[model samples]
Target: MSVSNPTLITFVIYIAAMVLIGFMAYRSTNNLSDYILGGRSLGSVVTALSAGASDMSGWLLMGLPGAIYMSGLSESWIAIGLIIGAYLNWLFVAGRLRVQTEHNGDALTLPDYFSSRFEDKSGLLRIISAVVILVFFTIYCASGIVAGARLFESTFGMSYETALWAGAAATIAYTFVGGFLAVSWTDTVQATLMIFALLLTPIIVLLATGGVDTTFLAIEAQDPSNFDMLKNTTFIGIISLMGWGLGYFGQPHILARFMAADSVKSIANARRISMTWMILCLGGTVAVGFFGIAYFSANPDLAGPVTENHERVFIELAKILFNPWIAGVLLSAILAAVMSTLSCQLLVCSSALTEDFYKTFLRKTASQVELVWVGRAMVLLVALVAIALASNPENRVLGLVSYAWAGFGAAFGPVVLISVIWKDMTRNGALAGILVGAITVIVWKHFEVLGLYEIIPGFIFASLAIYIVSKLGAPTAGMLSRFAAAEADFRLNK
Candidate 1:
């Protein structure tokens, strides 16, 4: 379908506004810290929303909803898993990370945090962790690219290659110019757009399909299994689905929000706001897919796009049900989702390269201005690699996201959680955990072991490695003192 004038105009205006925000943020970004972590000065609302927006990404709209539409309510387990995981992450990790990162050399990236926390003088932790981030996040960024391309391809009738570059252009522009501040600010706006689209679209879908009761009746008529949340799902399947929650502890982009918050005190309020937004958004996503079953069943003639690609359900519904102007606004939410996450992922990759590698190894005396510019250049470099990875039109957004999600969760989740909470977790232990977690995920994913999600095994083994290795060796006295200081600071803030 050719893009309508209103849709085209909306797209143009939204892209322009995001780019404008980048320029605005550029004025505030003066140093490496400002460019990478917004100088640790984000308020609770922006922190909360930005974290939610970045965490949800395109998968919340396209991947999760598409899964539900194809497999019925059974697929909602992933949402359930994520909600549980996100809440725990906020409760346990958010405040502590804020305090710990600040105390531990004011670390700007996850690898930086790991290195400082363990006092890894050899720089092995920093290098390995940075490599893991680059490898997985490159894949993660590609998922965003794939999602954006899908949006453009379906909306504008562009070829996959054209859509791929077109979709990535705006995100890269803002991230390249403004860095973290721009990404966070734009994320707040994008989060609002996403929730509006998600909540509003499902309500319209319900009304268009008659009502909730009528919608359920139609769904049941089409397939009784549509209502069965447990239909055809084995115990392992449910465990694998719920295992998605474990990923929350390790995701660098989301954790960066915690590290960047204005204060540890902000974490409580931010957690409340973030969780509420997440639950509502997840519910809307589920509603869209569940109700979409009825809407399409009652009007099969208009179901061709969704029938071909279940991931396009939200996109198809937005275009078909709403007026041209309203549809344009709603459709912009897809771009918003794509940009919010992709921009942050790009920034995180840039931070890993610039802060962890470039300044640490390549140029110890690199000035703040120089580092900031190098960071921007890294953003562009990562974007190009991601675009190449996403060149395949056949790549599924969920498939790519799941792999990268598992990679981060397993590779860094146990290490991060243990580092903050357990003083006895030695540097060797931390290194063991990282290696074990990452390798387990890679191997398990390759073998497709027991049909269990790689994250489950990866997390379990990583945690074990940390414990066993720590038992063999104790933390240095200096390490213990730093841990105590962070804990005291956290208590005061709490």
Candidate 2:
């Protein structure tokens, strides 16, 4: 596990390059809008890749692969669920949200969009949504931190404490400096690195294991049940895994990419590009885990780290299967995944604080430069909190992510979906949906109710709450008119 000079140098170059991108983005960010949403000027390719990269996170390389390596094909259900969910999010929500957010007073954050969309004079929607974002995203950012720490800790044999801070520093540095554009631009680069690594690693592993037949043979020989997707999973377990797709409707980081697109028309091409990349990356992720079983079965000695921590499956495979120089680049993809997601999560949290709270309440007349600096400061602040939360060495990246993912999915998914499409949805209904959805997730997760994923109950209840409440109270005339206008714009562009 000793780190080679080539690997260390590669790591340094990659980190430095990301910081350089951040500095480049800093120049583009003269105002609060540019700082938070890239001035709504990202092209289709950048938008697609950045959205994909931010959505996948370290979970694609580390968490999902590890799960599949440990338990076989049953773990692929989450990937399947995610693909379905992401596509639906793009089809149903992406273009519409781009138009709706712009129509709703050019909102820069989800909380701001909700406030404008519903005309919430009391600021209740903005406050609650922002609080939900800060709470869940802090935990979400912590997952990225833990994944990064694991990478540095495994790659360089650094102590967990040192690795934790080291892993977080580069992401925080760039995000603190470059703001949204830095994160988005680096996300494109990171996304490219991620796909190359995911696609390359599995192919190499398959070849090393003597090809597809031999790989499957070895997998079957190691454990016959490894071939069965349904072997260990129950009906509810399968359903719970599939429910992950439902979370896509509500992820702020992913939705922000849609909002930042140069035009609503661009979203069609972006959706196509994003989904293609997602499918390829996810397929490779599963292949690495599935093929790793074969590779490790033939070389049990090198399987030690993977056995100790299943999430290290990709890391160990990359180090063992490639030369130090090639391995360094591949390993950097893990960092890329971590940084891409972490940077966006940090930016989203910063926007929530800076736009939704600070400017909205404390400084309504704050200058663009001042707000941009405040946004950077908030990035640092949130990174500090996430680092503190990730101080524990035992936190699993997937576990932390699932909890936070369900929180956002349940709390905002129904409200977001219904609001953009349903003109009858009242502000009260949106409020009820948020409360019910978020509370259901928290309570369900706490009680481990029915062993079902909290998002299932949360999404269902939130949808029901929105429908029932809206039925009881009608939208104002202005709300109806705004919805009609936004819908017209969406249809025209679509």
Candidate 3:
């Protein structure tokens, strides 16, 4: 009924598993491509779970629960937005990206694909894209580092600064050793463990507090707002909250999985599996947070300080509701969320540097071995930067991610979407879109205003500008034909 030694043991085992997965992947790794894309041989299950795991991340564990805890049922709208966006992204982007990247001589990275696909004479497109990826992804990766540090600070009482380096180092070491395949495989395993923890913990908490209906009744009785789906926000705020869904269209980490999949045929299966897992795991985490309120409200004596602040809902829930054995598992689940995400982001940033910038521009004939080393070196450098920045590890997960997500979504989302669907999307237009998006996000964050998030405005403006500017550009016969083909494909597919 109380904190037990078994819970601590459970946690150690979970950490050991993470380390083991990395080492196992490290030994089997042969070269850069294998490290970055698993040599483009990932099956549906591996792609599905790895993608879902990487996507849900600490945002799911820490951000979503904290939202539900602080704002009650209103937070679920973000889930709804994400589910809708994820399903559409897998359907539209995944199948085509797999084929397109393969068709373009098996392009290895997002910037590589972008450059190769358009055959732009200017290398400015690739260089600019690489810079944007680095800038936004650094912020994104730092946020994940923050999450990992908070995990230790919240659960094990480790100080924030120490935890930051330890978590970042662990992720960077494995990611550099194993590369993309290792990350995906480890992601698959870490993701499964995370889903198990999420599902098992909520069910156990609900049962201990009584049946499902009893838990619901208790939460509703405690605060009517807890049951209200739109508890404390206006229409725009709610929409802005859920608007996070739109960022998926531009995320490099998620798109990289599609490019790495074994084949296009596997995408349908991957989509089905990934979406189902997202709904279940994300839904379960929200329930755990919501249910934690009921358990705590009913037994306030054991509540401690966490109830006053929802950021620690998961941590508090693990301590109060389960015996140490199960609590250890719960704690591991939290780490699963943090580590899986941090490792993925770190690998993506390193991949951007090695595959997109170095291999393409610096050394056209670089061996895979050399490329892999560059990736590993970048991993160490970026992780060091992230640890240095995570001085305040306890910042809101969603907010941290939002700044970076909005940057990527606005900067790349429009250009990426247009490039696939509108062939005349010029190098100039792409650059404009990227610059506009990045600037808008920076401005929006510094100068907060009403209405949807900065991403929405940035996306719309970038899309509009690209459309107008691309139309004005003098297109070659080849470019015009490509545009026609894109239109034809859209019509036939629709």
Candidate 4:
């Protein structure tokens, strides 16, 4: 199939704008801190939108709608869980993390904070945390690539292999050139595009289906189960879905947003803005997926594409329900979702490599300019590795996302919560918690006999490990002192 001229132009313009932002950010970047965390100068709106954009990713646009299309309202439990989790993360972690990270030796990365907070003289905490980030983020970033490949394959009628590289190229170029500033600025734009597309598409879809009541009836006429919100929803299933929220505490990219905010006071405003955007976009996404069911029911023969690939519902509807120019803009929303998340992931990976491993261990005396370039180089390298992992056409974006989400949520979530709120948390406790949490997620995912999501068990065990180990290891005087100082500083800032 040949590509439409309007869509091609829109896409080119969008990509060009992103690259230009990168060049602009490159000019502003003077040191490693500016490259990695935007010099800790992000305002409320940028912080909120960037965090939301990076957190939602393609899973919001593709995996989510696809699931709702196939599984009905039951799939929405995940969204509900995430909403609660995100709120708590912002309320509890965001302000505290910003203040604490600055107070705790002005730590630049998550691993840096952990090592500094615990006074880990042996560097074991930093190495293990960085390794976990690298391992899980490789798989996490692959999900975003798969989503971009799916979009390119459908939108431009390209081969999956070609689409894979093309999908990653723009994200890599901008992230490699502009660093954190570039990623944050692009994410703010992408988040706006995503919400606009989601909001507009749902309204158009609902209107075309005659309205909510009529749409629900059309869906029920085909399959009554499609309208049932609790068809197969069990206690365990709901728990598992909601467990997605737990991953919020552990996500390196989201946490980076809080760490980069202009001040502690900015967090409250950012949280409110972010939550509002999240709820509205989530509602829109659910409506679009549900509307796909009705639209297909009204035209059975025309449903082949959606039936063949549920993830293509949004793309298919964009073309069918709107004019070429408008459809192109709508489709760019998918690209926005993909690029926003991928850039953030690559930046986080680069930071982990540069701040946690490269500067800390490999080159202790490296200059600011050298560190910035090294970070950029790692961004390109990490994106390539993720692209390779995403090469397989059989991978489902949601499945990959779920696995990685569980890995990060279970492994880091418990440790982060304890470290910030509990002064008695020891270095050994943090290490044990991370190792136990990460290992449990992997082991539980493989066995597949629990009839529960892996995060539930992984979180439980990880939290337990931290408490038990902390008591056994005994908190050192330095750890307690650092905790007190962090608390005092947080109070002053708040």
Model 4 scores worst on lDDT over the 10 consecutive residues at: 222-231
Per-residue lDDT value at 418 in model 4: 80
- Candidate 1 is scored at a TM of 0.99
Show model 3 residue runs off by greater than 4 Å. 1-5, 474-494
> Which residue pairs show backbone clashes in model 1?
none
Residue-wise C-alpha lDDT for candidate 4, range 142-205, written one tens digit per residue: 9999999999888889999999998999999999999999999999999999999999998898
TM-score of 2: 0.99
Worst 10 residues of 2 by lDDT: 1-10
Q: List the global CA lDDT of all models.
A: 0.95, 0.95, 0.78, 0.91
**Candidate closer to the true structure by lDDT (higher is better), 1 or 3:** 1
Clashing pairs in 3: 7-324, 7-325, 35-179, 35-180
Give a tens-digit lDDT track for model 1, residues 252-322. Answer: 99999999999988999999999999999999999999999999999999999999999999999999999
Residue-by-residue lDDT tens digits, candidate 2, 1-494 = 48779999999999999999999998899999999999999999999999999999999999999999999999889999999999999999999999999988999999999999889999999999999999999999999999999999999999999999999999999999998999999999999999999999999999999999999999999999998999799999999999999999999999999999999889999999999999999999999999999999999999999999999999999999899999999999999999999999999999999999999999999999999999989999999999999999999999999999999999999999999989999999999999999999999999998899999999999999999999998888888888899899999878
lDDT-wise, the better of 1 and 4 is 1
Candidate 3 lDDT by residue in tens digits, 321-416:
677777777777767777777777888788888887788779989987888889899988877777777677546677888888898888887776
